[model samples]
Target: MAPSYLSIALIVLGEAFASQLPLFETSSLSQTHLTAKELISSKSLQDRIHVDNLLERANTLYSIAQLGEDEYNHPTRVIGSKGHLGTIDYIYSTIAQLGDYYTLSNQSFPAVVGNVFESRLVLGSEVPQSAIAMSLTPPTKKKQPVFGPLALVSNFGCDASDYLDLTSKIALISRGDCPFGTKSSLAGRAGAIAAVIYNNEKGALGGTLGTPSPDHIATFSISDSDAALYIKKLKDGEEVQASAYIDAIVESIETTNIIAQTKEGDPENCVMLGGHSDSVTEGPGINDDGSGSLTLLEVATQLVNYRVNNCVRFAWWAGEEEGLLGSDYYVSVLSPEENLKIRLFMDYDMLASPNFAYQVYNATNSLNPVGSEELRDLYTEFYTSKGLNFTYIPFDGRSDYDAFIKHGIPGGGIATGAEGVKTEKERQVFGGVAGDWYDPCYHQLCDDVGNVNLTAWELNTKLVAHSVATYARSFDGYPKRTGIEATAVLDVPLSKYHGPKLQV
Candidate 1:
């Protein structure tokens, strides 16, 4: 005999009750005068949001690293790390305290996190220059320092023919035209013992192989000056002997995305906003994303004091540094009906670059979804009303919103800036050093709580709160949700989305 629906429901309810999971109950609203309609009126909720609250939360996130010795050395909230897991616990517990007002779930997913233990490049016994190991490059099993005669490859080394007769030599390639992975694979196939790729333009080279490849030998990148000197030495009939070493670990780890949605609103129409929860292995990443994550958390926490018309979902995504894995996984697993319920998606990332610019995602482009333009306009209007000048950055699917956009969901967000150098024109408009990077400590050990620009951080957080409040009040100006299968029409390479190439 099959079980009845009522009996199944009773069993599920019993399990939930036994587990002490808080379930949504509309009766709870009677205890407070802050009803959904009242909460949205006259920008009341926005006024309640304070920058102090956001900073306090950010400090709390930073303190998570101070809890124990393991995190003290790393001091990073990278996914699967102790600091990151601690961050997850904080968010989960914080949201769980809201009880019936919000429904919270931890979405689990698997991700492979890579960390470069040691990377070095020794050219002809000169002072060894620092070189970043390309992500996913296999460790050399032969010896600690693989020695070889340096040979230059032609045309970016994308083809096998470009690496002919390179047996037992270190193939030196330039950055351009193809991925670092392609060049590395071609070097390995041509019987080269190791590979060194230098930057074509100015500055240090930092990139990834996109994925792990067996054909990828140990590869590293140096500066353009270093490569130029080596090429010139080789052309002058000087043998350039190079030694390269890289030790790295790539491990599959399990992580969770903390998701919370308002229980008081219409679930059929939902507004989603999120930022990456994890940081790079270098530091605590307080500004890289701690600014954005805590902004969402602060906004979500304050929103619990009120109500909403349409559901607002807040997510703290993991594995974002590993190429948007968490957000991508979240969207990939959603059913068609679930996808359609999402009216719009907003991403908040890197909102506190030390040298900042108020940048909104460029949704006016042809590559955006049907309703993205309106979303962009809403942000523009919000900034304009405040007498702020903002610029439109390309929506190149680099951040967490990439997945949402690929699912046909209209997506937009704001960024202060990252490693991109601030130009003189931007300096005239935003009042910052012209040649300085937006965030000098991006993905570095210095990206701690002190790396934030409080002015930008506070302003960006308020903008987040405003957006949330506006959309939660009503989706009247936004287009109806479309269930059409999404394709990345503007699929620009990830390299184009960020500033200059920095460390991986």
Candidate 2:
């Protein structure tokens, strides 16, 4: 059990000390409480899910992201950023209110965090277009830029041969097929002094290299239109040389994963749910994940009022935006015995895209674990019972569930959508723009509180409540977790992906 006194101490210290924590709120402690002895059910739990509570949480997260403006120059909650630390404290303090009802532990880990001080990209005498330095990339020297003739590489720069004959030149690569780190490394291997990646879609590009790569050269990302303009010039027999300068810093920073498990249930058979707590370096990520994070928070808060037959673990993962660092670390540290105790895992991400679709992960794929289909059915059934239309998303490993799924855990979740375009058929099912991106502000400076669609978010939050309550009551139809040795690893090259649809 967690040290119950810690919760008491935090409460007794008054709002002064807790207020010192970023975006701390005392208002949550006054919510309506239910009788602890009442049996938990789907209705009882879902009844407690309220839109007002979620909206308030969204406002708090937006406020937390704003706190970063003084330190990060933008509203952000990227790993190791001030806004992210505040998010951690806020979650910790909120869960701390449960006292010993939940066993809480802050799992600390080292992560590589990067920030762009400044970056500039110019295509031979043309006005400089907007660009952002890819995370974990080394910066160009002060006042010294990397310049050479521009050569658009064949394919997506996933292979070294694509950069042949491009020695000392700046390689222009498309965004797809592999990770940004792989592309940058391939460019460097071909003797390219610098590399530029353009978005496959019609927006400004923001990307990451996944991890530090010694072979990586200074890299920058530009929009698709900018790249098309330069591509046309080069194709029209015009010589295009590029000069790029990026001033950035990459360093190892300490961060933590917040894990809270119920103390009143069966520890050996646990039901786990999680969402990424940290956002991208862009805007306040209320929809990107703040929506999902608060879903878990609100559920866990109300969950304490009832008893459960199975232990429930609520994890607010850190460093997820930096390539699932926190969740991966969590899985790596668990012993085989400890891992088997987790019967199933559910992930919640992007529950509130402004242009939304009801999406549940497709568990029918042969790649999923034994019980995955059952988890999917639970969600589809809930939506069906409500006469709500939902679609199936591929198991692309784009979120924190990647680690658990990789290790053969039956995992499932819901998402409104990310940068992927919504289909006309989806428009017929769920009202939204068919040809537009689900969340246009995905990983951009506009994913603030306003980005969330409260209607969609509220409906998904109730689904989350239903899933938690059902599993907490009993894992009756759910398959029991088998020994680790019998589990087969999922055969997806998930590391190559950086977004919802794009490979890089």
Candidate 3:
């Protein structure tokens, strides 16, 4: 059982949590509410099943804690791709440490554009000394100031009409309703040499958000602090031009998805639990996903020894911070046949955002809900019994699950919340303060060690173990869960890939 407060929460769960508990669990089957205390002392399910040991292995948050920004953001996968090497090494030093039934797989896919627009910025004066990664093409020359070469987009918040009015200069704009990528790509299509996006928000643009620049266009996000001075000068009738250049050069660097298989007796279908291991160049994402990455690795270690009824594959995706590249590619590379073989998908993106609220992303009808409707329904029952108040967070299909769903695979997962926070309505439902940031550090440098909500992370970790263990133990026929909306046309294709129809 959880602490006293949690018990009260169960009671306060009132209608939804109370009535749904029994339906979520059965006597022949175990409930998903196994606490850390119970998990530590719980005996093996069968001679081959040991959930407690799995929890212990899944609790290696400290070792991942020791990983510096460099290691967390870098590639141990120097051979085939960049990212976690353990995923591909059928034999891993990490798995050897577990000394159990864990199989490392190359988990390799026909590499997609893992890295696009690797750039550097050094604004001499007009733009202060800062780092900016615009979705535009990289500059051929090193470190160009934001003047002379850049063109300013006047009256931004309005239509991009001003963009069409301008000639072949790098369009300078401010961030607003539209994404930087969208704006850059727009300018690029209009013959703009590149894009210089001055910050409209208060401080720095922080970290890379998404990859919108399809290809060939150069884009850069200038600091708002620095853009202020330029804007002030320009507004005051002082002409300010930036010397910016973008290199739209193409490169073929290998990127891989880490895959580790947990074998059981019968393996007609498989379940996937993963977190992207790649981090931004700006900082090591110990928390942006390090929290989740470490958590996923721990879960895999603990269960590597479990003997179960279904196949469970643990993955550590790369380039997620870089727009779900690793997960997207792995799924993109899979043949239609391979995709159909998947039973379900789970993502552990930000398991612990320091001072964050507990949240779960619900797969929707349009997203194919990541997995079969049956899985979503099962998860709903699982969370209900656990007394967890879950919000039906829309699936962005921006995680590894995106690829799986693209191929019609079933998917779902838990999240600790990100930049999106709870509104007054949300707070009312989940009990967190309204107006509080979901994760203040979100993707910034501050998302490092010592910045985590241990309780939230611990609970989520346990949730993963419970959900995964229960999933493995139950061998329901893959009759295809149903009842969510159909996949949306609004959903973008999984990858920016176009290869020989990838084989399963």
CA-only RMSD, every prediction: 7.1, 5.4, 12.5
Residue pairs with colliding backbones in model 1 are none
- Please give the TM-score that candidate 1 achieves against the real structure: 0.87
Model 2 Cα lDDT, one tens digit per residue, 1-504: 123323332342234332333332333323233223666789999999999999988888877777678777888888876677778777887887655567777888989987777778888777446576787787764536888998888887888777787787988899888888889899887888888998887788877886788788888888998788888887787889888888888889878898989877789999999999999876789997899999999999898778888889999998888778888899888899899988888999999999999999886535677887898899999999999999988777788877787676788888999988998999888998999999999989999988999999999999999999999999887787776543423335655553332337
Task: State the lDDT at 144 in candidate 1.
Answer: 72
Question: What do the candidate models score in CA lDDT, each in turn?
Answer: 0.77, 0.81, 0.52
Candidate 1 accuracy as lDDT: 0.77
Per-prediction TM-score to the true structure, in the order listed? 0.87, 0.86, 0.66
Candidate 3 error regions (>4 Å): 1-91, 108-132, 135-137, 149-168, 173-194, 198-218, 222-252, 366-373, 422-436, 475-504
Sliding window of 10 residues with minimal summed lDDT for model 1: 1-10
Candidate 1 local lDDT, 1-504, one digit each (tens): 112212322232223221322343444545354463356532676677677777777777776644322634667777767677667767666666555667778788878777777777788887436467876677765537688899988877878878878887888898887778788888888888788888888877777665566788888887898778788988888998888887777677778888999877789999899988888887888987899888888788778777788899999998888778889899999999999999889999999898899998887536767788888898899889999999988777678888887788888899988888999999998988899999999988788778898898878877888888888889886788766468446446645432222222
lDDT per residue, candidate 3, 216-293, as tens digits? Answer: 355666677777766666566665544564433333445556577753433556767887765544344556666676
Clash pairs for candidate 2: none
Highest-TM-score candidate: 1
Question: Which order, best to worst by lDDT?
Answer: 2, 1, 3
